[model samples]
Structure formats: structure tokens, C-alpha cells
Target: MKSTVEHLSPTRVRINVEVPFDELKPDFDRAYKKIAQQVRIPGFRPGKAPARILEARIGRGPVLDEVVNNAIPAKYQEAVVSSEDVKPISQPDIEVTEIADGERLAFTAEVDVRPEIELPELEGLAVEVDETEVTEEQVTEQLDQLRARFGTLSGVERAAQTGDFVQIDLSAAVDGKEIEEATTTGFSYEVGQGGLIDGIDEALEGMSADEEKTFTSKLVAGEYAERDAEITVKVTAVKERHLPDADDEFAQLASEFDTLEELQENLRERLGQSKRMEQATQARDRLLDKLVEGAEVPLPESVVQGEVDNRLHDAVHAFDHDEERFAEFLAAQDKTREQFDTESREEAEKAVRYRLVLDALADREEISVNDQELTERILYQAQQYGMAPEQFVQQIQQAGQIPAIYQDVRRSKALINAVRSVSVTLPGGEAVDLSDLLGPEDDAEADEAPDTVEGEVTGESAESTESAESGADTADSTEGTAADAKA
Candidate 1:
């Protein structure tokens, strides 16, 4: 067997492979066995017929076809392994060139490959991030949140206000027909959360106990989604949260702190730490933007198209692949299919470029994802999807998505490495020390920093806490922050 590679472009290659007849004996045997099991012979038992006898019965062309079909994939893999530099990122476009009887088989495969990237110097890159400033007001807000957690609700005799909690019965009718899924009784909602139906807050604000109001709002979900519905909300009870006074007793009740002053100080320190973490997140995102913007990465068209197709498939899947419903959804968003296509293409290209940049950086830095890191990422993802780790692992393995997860973890680490190497400064040009947020290794060489820190400080650590606490979308957060820096 022999193989040769042709560089079609910076990010693609064509591999031509030839396998002599002697090398395909195993493939031929397997093909014969498979064919024999499907066909019956007059004298031989099932799957017990000799290869020559089977070939005589099925003809040489069918046997050869079976052998070629079974042999190509394995041979292609061998060809890839033999060529040390040919790393394909997409499925190959294979064409069998020749299959001479009793001679040799030849084929060519064209595929997208990782491009050679000329990376910029990591240490010399400089980026600016917001300074970590935990204001007194922020500390107060945190304390207020703590107090709210321990607050009690008492019935009120007045109209509902913005901060009031209310118990109400809701019913909706679209085109004079009641929507079953949109009706609920004895529902508790905060006055200004705005999550239930649109215009519910306005209707509730001025209503007192036992008062009913009807308002028209668009149903955002269920069968009547995007349709205007006449909603009748009847206020059963009005209540307001009565927070405890910020005193030593209240502090003792709310936390382990013996004094309110100590609780305030602790809250301030925690807020400072959170702000520093935010600074680190901003630095990570900005550094990634700088690296991607400064580098010249040739995107693979096939990979980008694959990503776009996946996104489109997911989008249409939510509407059960009904094209008309999808079109209606776009219309509701005030967007056309053309606009969605353009935006999806742009997003796909950006995502591909990001992955490419990080992969190149990972190679340059010799970054590797170990078993522990991979497991940790898998567990985290399982938690995100509300599945057990074992179940999640099984699902991903069956779906062949483990490699994608590994790649995401690798890219995340690569971006973190770039963040640590880059110089991060405040608006006033003062260099900010992110050692506390980025872990001690990030500042190990600094004269004033400690020798070591426990734990890794990557974007995952910074974003994971925020995502878990606020249920923030990690992709949207990163994209928004990166776009802000770019702008």
C-alpha cells in the first residue's frame, strides 16, 4: 500500500492512495463472508460457502464491489495515519480511481485540513480591562439581597406596587377562544419580573385585592404563541416583603457574623473578589479578541458550512421542521429568511475562526487536555444539561460528540493561556495583577507574587460561577463581551 498527499490549499488537501491486491486479503475475506451470509448455496451451509464458490455464484463484479466498499474506509484511515501532516477536519470526498481485477485498487480523497498559522508573540500582546472597583453601594446591595432572602411577606390592603408580591388567577383567550395552557390559578409572581405574559405587570400594579383587570398581550409560548390574547388577571391577595433592620441581631440571624459591621465588611470583601473575577473574565475575553483579530486564519469552508447547517437544523427542529412556522417565527422577530441566513453564516464563520485560532495557539503552546480536565468538563456539561454524569457520557459517546467536548475544553485552555501571557492594564495605564483571579501560576515569575496557587483559573472558572448563579448564557456572554471590546 502507498499514499501521496497534494496540498490543494492552505486549509485543504487531496490524498491519493493505492492498495495492491495482496494487501486486501482480509477485506476480501470479510466481504465474501458478508455476501455468503446473504446468498444461499445448493450444497454449502449458510455462511459456510467458500469464497471462490460465492464469487462464482454472485459474479466477480459484485464481489469486487463489496471488497472495494469494505476496504476504502480502512485504507483511507491507514493513508491518513501514514501521512503525518495530513490532519483532516471534515469528511472526505472520496472517488475510486481504479479497481483493476487481480491487480490493485486506487482512490483519491479531498478534505479540509487544519491550516498552518503564523502566530503572533503571546507575551507582547497588551489588552485593557475594567478596573476592579467594589463600591459601597454594591456592598449595600449585596447586603440587601441577603436581607431579602430572610424577609417575610405580609398581606397588604392597598394596590400592588413595583416591589409587591401578588397572588392572582390568570386566564387568556385568543380570538375569543380560551387557551388552556395559558390559564392558571393561585399563581405567585413578583410585580415587575416581566417574565409571565407581556402587560401583566401593568395590569397588576394598580389592582387591589379581589380586583380583576383584562388586558391584551402577546402569548409568547404554547399553541397561541405570538398571538395577541385577552388576559384577565384577578388579584387574590397583595403582599409586600418586610425586610429586617440591618442590626447586630439581624446579622446574627442571617449569617454567622456576630455584628452587622462584620457582615458588611465580609460582603464588601466578597464583592471585591467578585469584581476582580469579572475583571479577569473581561481580560480573558479581550485577550481572545486581540489574538483572533491580530492573527490571519484561513477558515475552512466545509467546516463553516457544516456548523451553519447544524445551527439551521436546530432552529428548524424547534418548529418541527415546518418551513411555514419557521418563516412565521422570523416574521415575528421582524427578520426575513435572507437576514437569518446572512446572520447565521456570519456567526458560523466567526465560530470557525475562533476555534481555528485557539487550536493553533494550543499547538504553539503545546497545550494538552488531560483525563482529569476532560472528565471535569464532561461532568460540568452533564450538570448543565440536568443529566447524570454517566448518562451524559453515554449520550455524548453514542452521538460521537466526545471529541467536540474535548476540543471545546482544549480551546478554552488555549484562550486562558493567551490571557495569562498578555499584559492587562486599567484605563489609567496601571498594570492590574490578576494573580488572585487567574491563580498563582499566572504571576509566579513576578517579584511580589507568591510561588504557587491551588486550582486552575481559566475562563471556565470565571464564567462557571456566574453562569450557575445567574443562569447566564456563556456563549452570549463571551460574544457580547468580545464584541464590546472590538467596538
Candidate 2:
């Protein structure tokens, strides 16, 4: 067997391969066996017919078709593995060129290959991040939240208003006909919470006990979704929450702290830690932006288009691929289909670029994921999707998505390594040290970005949030390539 490569672009190549008939012995044996099992030959047991006999009965065309189909994939993989220059990032476009019967077989595979990227110097790459500070307002907000949890409700002798709890009866009618699904009696609701309907807040406010108000609101679900319905609400009672005073006594009851001042300080410390994590995340993002900007990554049109198609497929899948329903969804969000397509294309380009950049970094650094690291990442993502680790493993394995997730974890470790080498500072030029939060390079890693479909740029790629939400992106089935679903 022999192979040659033709450079189609900076990101794609065409491989020409030729195999002498002798190399295809294993493929022929398998193909003949498979075919024989499916067809009956008189006087021969099932699957026991010889290749020559099967060919005589079934004709050469069928046998050759089976052999060619089985051999191409293996030969293509062989050709790629033997070539030092080829690193395919996308599936190959295969075309069988010739079949000199009893002599040789030839074919060509055109695929998207990773470009030769001269990455920018990553050592001590400087980036600016925000200063970590916990404001008094933030502390106060935390204290108030704690207070609300321990608060008690008391019946109020006044009209329902914002923050007041109301016991009310609600019923709605579309075109004057009753909607049973939209009707409830003695439902407890907090005024101004505003999840029930659009106009409920305004209607509930200023209504005293035993008072009723009729208004119209658009129904959001059920049989009358998006339709305006006449709604009637009768207030049975109004109650207001009485929160404990923010004093030493309240501090003692709410937390282990003995004083309000102590409680406030604790909140401030926790917030500061949270802010430091934010700074680490921000630094990672900014450094990625810096590196990608400095690197020369020519986009692969085929890979970009594939990413775009996947995004569009997911976007419409929620509506069961019904264009009309999808349009309605877009309309609700004030986005047109053209705008969505344009944005998707733009995102696809960024995602592909990010993947290429991180891949290059991983290679340069010789980044490799151990089984333990891969398992940890898998477990984290499984929790993110609310599935047990075993279940998630089974799903990805069934879908042949292990490579996609493995790549994601590798990319994450690459980004973390980059973060450690880069310099981070505050807006005022003061150096910000994030070693504790980001962990040491030897012990640190995350799996949440392009995190692609890339579980991609905006969500997965370049977005490494190690502290707050660092679980990387969701893994889709690996793209089709040299091996189907293993690209």
C-alpha cells in the first residue's frame, strides 16, 4: 500500500492512496464471510460457502462492492497514520478512484486537517483582571437574605401590596369561556413576585381583603397559550413578613457569630473569596482572548460549517424541527431567523478558532489526560446534566462521544496551564495573585469550556470558570471523520 498528500488549503488536505490486492486479504475474507451468511447457496450450509463459489453464484459485482466498502475506511486510516503531516480535525470526503481487478485498488480522501500554527509565547503572558473586593452593599444583601429566611408571617390589616403575602382565588376565561387549567382557589402568592402572569402584580397591589379585581392577561401555557384571557382575582387575606432586627440577638440566632459585626465580617470574607474566583475566571478568559488574537489560525470552512449546522440543529430541535414553531420562538425573543443564522455562523467561526488554538497549546505543552482526570471530568459533567456518572458514561459511550469529552478535558487543562503562566493584575496595575483559588498548575484542571457545541467560544471555548461554574461544556457525539463518529 502507498499514499500521497495534496494540500488543498491551510486547513484541509487530500490524500491519495493505492493498495495492492495482496493487502486486502483480510478485508476479502471478512466480506466473503459476511455475504455468505446472508445469502443461501444450494448444497452449502449457511455461511459455509467458499469465496469463489459465493462469487460465482452472487456475481463479482456484489463481492467487489462489499470488499471496497470494507477496505476503504481501514486503508484511509492507515494512510493517515503513516503520514506525519496529516492531523485530521474533520471527517474525510472519500472517493474510490480505481479498482484494477486482481491487481490493486485506489482512492482519495479529502479532509480538514489541523493547520500548522505558530503559537504566541505563552510564558508570563500578561493580562489584566478586576480587583477582588466585597462591598458593604453586598454584605448587607447577604444579611438581609439570611434575615428573610428566619422571618415569620403575620396577618396584616391593610390592602395587599408589594412584599405582602396574599391568599387569593384566580380564574381566567378566553373569549369569555372558562379555562379550567388556569383556575385556582385560595392560592397563596407573594405580591410582586410576578411569575404567575404579567399583570398580576399590578392587580394584586392596593386590593384589600374580600376585594375582587377583573383584568386581562396573556396566558403563557396550556390550551390557550399566548392568548389574552380575562382574569379575576379575589383577595381573601393579606399578610406581611416580620423580619428579625439586624442586632446581636439576630446574629446569634442566624449564625455561629455572637455579634452583628462578626456576622457582617464573615459575609464580607465569603464574598471576597467568591470575587477572587471571579477574578481567576476573568483572567482565564482575557488571557485566552490575548493568545487567540496573537495566533494565526486560518479557519476551516468545512469544520466551521459543521459547527454552525450543529448549533442550528440544536436550536430548532426544541421545536421538533418545525420551522413555524421555531419562528414563533424566535419572535418571542425578538430575534429573526436571518439574525439567528448570522449569529450562529459568527459563533461557529469563533468556536472553531478557539478549539484550534487550545489544541495547538495542548500539543505544544504535551498535555495529556490520565484516566483519573478523564473520569473526574466525566463525573462532574454528569452531575451538571443531573445524571449519575455511570448513566452519563453509558450514554456517551453509546453515542461514541468519548473522544469529544476527552478533548474537552484536555482543552481545559491546557487553558489552566496557560492561566498559570500568564500574569494577572488589577485594573490599577497591581498584581493579582490567584494561586490559591485556581490551584497550582500541577494540581489544577477544569473541563467546562468549547467547553464545544463546543460545550464553543461563547459558552465552552475560552470560558474557564474554575470556582463558580467550572464544569466545562456539554459533550455531543464526536464529529464523523476517518472513523465515523470519532472525528
Clashes of each: 0, 17
Each model's lDDT = 0.74, 0.76
lDDT of 2 by residue, 1-487 (tens): 9999999899889999999999988988998999999999999999999988998898999888989998898788888878876777766789999999899999999988779888889876899987777788889999999998999999989998799999999999989899999999989999988888889999999999999999988777765665678999999999999999999999999999999999999999999877776787777777778878899999888777777777787777666677786777678778999999999888777777777777788889988877777787677677777898899889867755566666666666777778888788888889887776655564524443223111222234221211111111212122221110111
Which ten contiguous residues of candidate 1 have the minimum total lDDT? 477-486
- Report the lDDT tens digits of candidate 1 across residue range 1-487: 9999999999889999999999999988888888889999999889999988987887899889998998898898888778877767777889999999889999999978778888788878888988778788898899999998999999989999998999999999989999999889999988998878889898898899999999998887776667678999999999999999999999999989999999999998887776776777678777778777888999878777766776688788777787887888889899999999999888777766766677678778876767776687677667667899999889867755556555555556666666778888999999988865555332322211111121122222322211101111111112111100111
Evaluated against the true structure, the overall lDDT of model 2 is: 0.76
| RMSD versus native structure for model 2 | 5.3
Candidate 2: which stretches are off by over 4 Å?
Answer: 168-187, 194-196, 210-234, 444-487
For candidate 1, the per-residue lDDT at 443 reads 30
Off by over 4 Å in 1: 440-487
